[model samples]
Target chain A: MYLHHHPFCPHSRFVRLLLAEYGLEPELVEERVWERRPGFLALNPSGETPVIVEEMAASVPGAFIIAEYLDETRGLALGTHRLLPEDPAGRVEVRRLTQWFNEKMYVESTEPLVRERIHKRYMSREQGGGSPDATSLRMARANLRYHLKYIGWLAKARKWLAGERLSQADLAAAAHLSVADYLGDVPWDEDEHARDWYARIKSRPTFRALLTESIPGMPPSKTYADLDF
Target chain B: MYLHHHPFCPHSRFVRLLLAEYGLEPELVEERVWERRPGFLALNPSGETPVIVEEMAASVPGAFIIAEYLDETRGLALGTHRLLPEDPAGRVEVRRLTQWFNEKMYVESTEPLVRERIHKRYMSREQGGGSPDATSLRMARANLRYHLKYIGWLAKARKWLAGERLSQADLAAAAHLSVADYLGDVPWDEDEHARDWYARIKSRPTFRALLTESIPGMPPSKTYADLDF
Candidate 1:
């Protein structure tokens, strides 16, 4: 299998973590989505990443779809490391939290902050990529705190975000937080339980590849790769 | 089952359509999300619509989660109305299209149009909703056409939006378009194939409830409920 992705995109990173957790190492190709390269668009008309081309020549796009695809195909092979719970209700909770991060946290926090702090540097001025807008960044930061508190609340109520076992919900939350952490945006000290929960996820072997990814001219924060932090 | 929803919210409507298709009738309770009702927030801290209280006493929130929950629990009982395909690849395709409508189409078209044309009337002047912004509506309309063309393209390529059999992808597409149609925003003449696909979905018994719903002081367009249209 081969995967096309952007280094800083949370969704892309989510898929990478899932792949690593499944113990499958697909060839990774970095995609510059803003350029809308015709080749990439041909592979996935939505012009987004990460797009996974299976050995059977099937092209799977969108992070949520890819995660489900991987689970359905290879999750059982792992024996007990399945990213989704087998029961219907447990699956519902995992998917709910997954969508919560993928859509809610993304729209309200991750997307705006990343676009402002990271993507703007790579984009042309005509594409609205100059200095980051202070107002937007401030709004996103404000939104981030509420999400962190919610994470803390969930952490206190359940062993994992969705239940007793690790699931896509944990991966999804970690994926978004990792990107924000790279930019030094996550105020980890604000919520101790949330930070502790994240620490557990951060130390996992699957997360090692993500922590070391450095974008050109946009290095991650000094503490980004530190497991102790 | 009980569902708290808003008549104009596409996600809410999507859940309703799924329930109807599954032959499960959930008692409906309209939620004014903009008001941020304390009771509703307790049920779902996100304060979003389409929260389902199942017979098992689980509060299944979010449209995607609820759809999967219903499918997993009751899909087998029906034998043929499964919203997700059995195979992994087909499921990925179905989910990809579902996300395409839920996120991409929503961000580009539905949310903006609905907020401007419908939500604005319900909001107080202090809440920033007196009149519709002409620019937003125009941009949403332009984006709508591209999405409609994409839908048309997909419809022509497959028996249903995702594949040979109808799935959540078709319902998702129809759900968003149904809302747009309610406001007379969809130019059905732009794509005959897309229109025909929608007509087939619109004529289903499950859609009858949605067609008869009349939002106070905001009547649906003349052609909105006409299946023959």
Candidate 2:
């Protein structure tokens, strides 16, 4: 299995955490998808990532096709802790939150930060000299607190944001936060449960590779990798 | 079971499609959630529509939650047509496509159109707008084409959007396009596959309720519900 990802991408990080937690490490090849070409675009025409490739028949579907393939082929669901619930009602909650964090949180919170704080430097349009807009960062900073408050409410109610089990919800949240933490944007002290929950997840062995992630000219905070954070 | 929904809500329509496809009907109660003083908000602090109330639970999750409940409790998944594929890999593709339509396409495409073409009198300053901006709508319009183009490509490649099997991908895509069709936002003539697919799904008995939806100040195009169009 080959996973095409960008090093600092929250979506990739989210998928990586899942791979780590599940103890399945695929070979990772980083792709700068924004620097698009015909070959890479064909992998995901939408030009998004953490695209995982499984050697399925050509007729099969793609990214998600690979996930379902991986989950079933590896018998990942056979574990005592299932990523998705078997009970239909509970599974809905799992899937919804999995998407909630992936879509809503990504849109409302992480994407803004990445665009304002990170993308300009890498993309050719705003390559050099001009600083990433402080105003956009401030807007993201303002919007982020409300999002944390929302997540805090969820963490307060359930053992996990989605439900009683640690599922994709945790991975999704961690992925965004890990990327933000790389940029040093998350205010972990603001929400105790969210902070504590994230810390617990990061301390696990699977998170080690994520903690070791480093970007040039940008630095992780002193506590970025600390299990105690 | 009682479902709390508003007719124009895309999420509500998504669940409605599931109910229609399965030939299972749940009692519906309309709630003007924003006007409720701390009541409905307590049930779902996020305060989105398409919430379900089973016999015991205070507020069941959301549309995704209720749809799965019906699919399981009523054995709605038993039909010759399956929303999710039989295999896990195929199932994930359906789920991913479902979110792709709902989360991305909705935000990028339908939202701005709805706000511009509708949402003015029925909306408030606090509901994120009192007036829809034309600039945003223009951008949304451009983005909608790209989204449609992507879907057209996938539809062209597979017998169904997700795979050879007709699954939740169709329902998810249909859910949004049906709403757009009701408002007449979709340019049905844009692409052959998109038009053909839209017509096939709209013809289903499940789409009957959506075609009949009436908003307080706005009316749908005369042919909004016509399968022949």
TM-score against native, each model: 0.95, 0.85
In order, candidate lDDTs are 0.88, 0.71
- Runs in model 1 lying further than 4 Å from the true structure: none
Model 1, residue B41: C-alpha shift (Å): 1.3
**Residues A6-95, model 2: lDDT tens digits:** 777778887787777667787987877667767667766566787776567322223233434455555345585766666656666665
Among incorrect, acceptable, medium and high, the docking class of model 2 is acceptable
- In angstroms, how far off is B28's CA in candidate 2? 2.7
